[model samples]
Target: MTTSAKRLDSAARRAQLLDVADRVFTAHGVHAPLDLIVEMAGVGRATLYRQFPDRHMLLLALMERSAQWLATRARRLAHRDDAFFRLLDYMASRIVRSPALSDYWRTTRMSDPRFSDVYQEVLNAFAPPVARAQRAGLLHADVRADDIPLLASMLAAGLRGETDAERRQLVGRALCIVQRGLTPSAPGGCLPGTVNDLS
Candidate 1:
């Protein structure tokens, strides 16, 4: 094959591996067997190794992709004038959709500088609305930009629930409490649809 053909093949194989890896990792965590991923991807071991080299490298790639997707969503959310509420709503939606955030925190090696860098990028992506809310006095006085991470971490735990119903209930409850705590007292009570309430 020509060099151009080989490059295209390599790129196609890498995309296949990532698609398989997302399912495998979600089911078995990041340490799932390399042979299993290669088999599922319908690619040879050589192709897998050529693309990812190791489990850590594959995990980092997944993190990078997920972070890019999330940054795009966050940027859109920040366009809303209600930065505080929009940030929390964005976070709540993430908690419902992505279980990997919590899984990565629990399973990945925290000491890995690459992993730490990815986590930092996620935090920075989440910071804009949080900082804006603070400046606007929309968030509680005690809240810091760093506090958004803990909120996300907690919501992520809710998503790790064993069953679909459980995950839904947990996230719903957590979001309620979060919005109540963050809202200014002037808006009635914690009832949903009220000006101050956040469901």
Candidate 2:
């Protein structure tokens, strides 16, 4: 075959492997065997190794992909008046639907230095909308930028219902309750705790 065609095929195979790896990793956690990924991708061991030299590299790629997805969505909503809350809902929905991914995130520690860059990317994307919401008095002034993800996690916990319909209802109710608490209070009144006080 032609060199150009071979290159195109290689690129396609690489992307296919990444997609398969994403699903497998999310479903099986980071420690999942590469053999499962290779099997699911329908690719040879050599091809999987060529695309991702190790499991760590594959996990990093998945994190990058998820970060990029959030960044893109954040950018699209940045101009809206309620972008902060909208973005929160977007992330919460993702967590509720992707149980494995959510479990992985919950199990992983954010303080790990290797994930700092990924964390920063998400924080940067969230910062502007958060600032805008605070300025407009839509979100509580006491709510710092970092609190958004934690809040989403809290709200998404309601998704542990038995059925999808039940989970959807629970998520909606949880968001409503949290959003109400997030709304600005009367003058001289704020949320019960400062941003640093999670307890």
Candidate 3:
């Protein structure tokens, strides 16, 4: 094959691999076998190894994809006039939609330093919006940019209940408390259905 054709083929294979990895990782966690990913991706073992030298490399790729997915969600929710509230709503909706993300997060943290680096890169993309929200007096001024990750952890912990309804209530109550603390002057209490505009 010509060089150009070779490059295109490589790009296509990479995309296909990542798509399949997403499904397998979500269902089986990061510890899932390499053969499982290869089978799911419909690629030979040689092809998988050629693309990703080892399991770590494949996990890193998946982490990058997951981070980009999250940053996209945050950007979409950043449209509200109140940047702070919008960010909180975005995070709340994100938590509700993908409870599995926390598992991936823990896996990333346990992986190589490069994994943490990529995770931070993705988190940074969403930080500017949070900062802007704080500046607009919509988000709690005391809430530092670094606190977002901690907040995510706390929210995820609260959502670790047995039943879906219990998890939902935990998340809702956590968001309400956080929002209220952020907007003390607002007369009305945390009403349901108002926060998750981005959802």
Candidate 4:
């Protein structure tokens, strides 16, 4: 065990690596060197390896962390009628800050079974809020549960930005466009009685 690993318990050390990996993956894209994660995390290669056997493991852990955060955000906004919109804002903020994370995420196709848990977690977290928003007439009735991921992918196009400010600007614009299209009263919300179950 490394000196740092010896100092922290297993759970603490694991969490430390994850937090460091999150920032490193944000700054450098997902393919950033593992040695850099070790250097920034102040842990030995063995330590990081012990916590995350490979880059994919680390990346999936980050995705799971994100799902948990969204779940928490949903719970926090449980009392608000605008919970769904607030959740969209929250996701947009994350995408703006760490658009680089989208690099690896894009590679993980939805058909890949490895991503099912994270995908399911997303559905579990957002489905109800989406339904509530539609029922309240805040969103178009044509918008279905699966549409959330598709909408998020559209928003995440901001990841193409060359710089942080550019990313924020692009994501902001994307969010505005998305919000307009999703709003029930908006012109582009949907066609009358048309539904897109995406089946």
Candidate 5:
């Protein structure tokens, strides 16, 4: 081990494992062998196990990392008029790179306690921006904060593409459609006349 590697404490080691695992899972799917993760991280199987008792546990850690990322990003975009849309752009970038993680999230039982916690984090991240957009007449009356997850799920449809470039193109197209639907129409435009924010 390098001198720096030797210096990593338990928490640091756990984080390092997750970082490596993120790349491995993105390339190999969540079912990729834990042994490979250990090998790539230059850590023993026991050490990996010490940080994550099992694959599910490790997956949960990754989910937490995702939620943390969303929260941090949401905070950063809080002040923008288009914060909600901007946050979605950031989310698409992450999801595109981490298809395996998002796939795992989608397949997991909705009732799972851990799943609920992570999903709630996602909801919380968008709530402020969603409300602001609605209050500002930026979003349609039918759009609600709870609807954000549905939009996110719709974005995941882009994941079907085999290539990263193809996936990005698909996500971009989907976002354009979604943003149009959520946005209030022009005067006498589609749906009822646009509700001007005027604030």
Candidate 6:
């Protein structure tokens, strides 16, 4: 095979492995055996290690990829009048569909400071839309941008079903309830508590 073709093949294989890893990690969690990933990807152990030197590296890549995906969606919705709610819905859907990822985040406290930078980027993406929603009185005046993740987590907790369709339905119901609570009771009305109030 040509060198260029071989290079393409290598890139494709790496992506394929990452794709499999995403599914396996989501189904099993970050600490799941590498053998499951290799088996699912139809790749050998050497290939897995070659693509990702170790499990931590693989987990980091997965987390970064997931964060990037959400950030991209948030960016697209940034200009909408209800961007905050749209982003919340987007996150709720993702969490319900990827329960393993939700569980992983809940169970593992990311100790690495570098991961905080990624988290900050996501928070930044969420801020403008949240501010817009508050200014427009679509959301309660007391709601802070930082509260978005907590609200999303609460909604995500309600997701459950035997199948993807069922899970989506459950998440939809949960979001509906949460959205109603989030909406201002009257124009410019504030919720009883702000983010600081919780603390």
For model 5, the local distance difference test gives 0.79
Candidate 5, residues 71-131: lDDT per residue as tens digits? 9998998987678877777777776778898878767764788778888888899888988
Q: Worst lDDT window (10 residues) for model 1?
A: 190-199
**What is candidate 3's lDDT per residue for 1-199, written digit by digit as tens?**
9999999999899989877776675566567787888988777999988989997787677667766766776677676546545555556655655455455564344245676676676567667776777667666667766676666666666447556566667777777777676663755678456543434
Residue 66 displacement (Å), model 6:
1.4
Segments in model 3 whose C-alpha atoms lie over 4 Å from true places? 72-80, 83-101, 107-112, 158-173, 186-199
Per-residue lDDT tens digits for candidate 1, residues 2-83, read 9999999878877778878887776666667878898888878988888899987887787777767667777877865355
User: What TM-score does structure 1 among the candidates reach?
Assistant: 0.75
Per-candidate TM equals 0.75, 0.77, 0.72, 0.87, 0.86, 0.77
Q: lDDT tens digits, residues 1-199, model 4?
A: 8987776788788888888988998888888999999999888999999889999899998888888999999988877766787787778787876666665665578788999989888878888888888878888888876776787898888777888777777777777788888886777543322222111
In model 5, the Cα lDDT at residue 157 comes to 87
Query: By TM-score, how accurate is candidate 3?
Result: 0.72
List the global CA lDDT of all models.
0.68, 0.73, 0.67, 0.79, 0.79, 0.72
Better of 1 and 4 by TM-score: 4
Q: Cα miss at 144, model 3 (Å)?
A: 1.5
- Give me the overall lDDT of model 2: 0.73
Q: Comparing candidate 1 with candidate 6, which one achieves the higher TM-score? A: 6
Residue pairs in steric clash, candidate 6? Answer: none
Cα RMSD for candidate 3?
3.7
> Model 6: residues >4 Å from true position, as ranges?
1-12, 28-31, 110-114, 159-166, 186-199
